[model samples]
Target: MRSFHVSKPRVITVDKNPAYPVAIQQLKQKKKIPEGIQIRQVKYLNNIVEQDHRFIKKRVRSMLGFKSFDTATSILSGVEAMHMIKKEQIDLRD
Candidate 1:
């Protein structure tokens, strides 16, 4: 959330985890996230997000672990870029 530098989300969808409610409550009390923001634990919504990143997870899982944070970051960024290109979400210009 801090890294994205985006506006506060009006809603946050997460899986049905016991800890999520506690953590979200703490964040709201600390003014980290808006108090009015809603949290949905619909399995379908979570499934969609997981499916979208399924490719990335499969690729990373085979690697076992990354040697360094910098290398991991670069590799993951490249993976995401390639995914976007394949999806035609990015246009290439020479």
Candidate 2:
């Protein structure tokens, strides 16, 4: 909201979720997003996010559910660590 008020972007692309338009309307009512700002709900606009989430989702589903916050955090941390390894963004030494 701060960015919207400060920069006052000309156009914003969001998911095709119907809730977004309503939320934007609320923002306009609150004078956050400018009245003339264009809000586009594009399909496949969030594909990159969805793709990234898929990897995490797969691991979580396979585990069914994590028993505790510490375990969940540690497990997800390792998952992301391996992902970074595969992407060559980080190196783990033996």
Candidate 3:
């Protein structure tokens, strides 16, 4: 979350995971996240985002696992770039 360097969100929608509520509470108590932020435990709200990453998951599953964080980060970044290009989401010409 801190790595994104974005403004605090007003709401966070997550899957019905048992640990997420506890984790969010802990972050609030530690002042890492705002206390007033709303948490919604919805099953389908995340489907769109999850669907978008399905291709990446399928691609990485064959590799078993990455040996280093730096290598994983580099490879994942390239994968995402290629995905965007394939989807025509990014314009190649400057």
Whole-model Cα lDDT of every candidate shown, in order: 0.85, 0.83, 0.88
Looking at model 1, the pairs that clash are none
Q: Compose the digit string of candidate 2's lDDT tens values, residues 1-94.
A: 4565566579777778899899999999999767998888788876555567677899999999899999999999999888878888886776
The list of candidate 3 runs beyond 4 A from truth reads 1-8, 87-89
Cα distance off (Å), candidate 2, residue 70: 0.9
Model 1: lDDT equals: 0.85
Off by over 4 Å in 1: 1-8
Give the per-residue lDDT of model 3 (tens digit) for 1-94. Answer: 6677777779887888899899999999999888999988897785566678888888789999788999999999999999999989999998
Question: How many angstroms is residue 28 displaced in model 2 relative to the true structure, after the best TM-score fit?
Answer: 10
TM-score of each: 0.75, 0.54, 0.73
Ten consecutive residues with minimal summed lDDT in candidate 2? 1-10
- Candidate 2 has an lDDT of 0.83
Residues 1-94 of candidate 1: C-alpha lDDT, one tens digit per residue: 5777767778888888878889999999999878999988766664666677888888889998689999899999999999999989898977
**1 versus 2: better lDDT goes to:** 1
TM accuracy, model 3: 0.73
On TM-score, the leading prediction is: 1
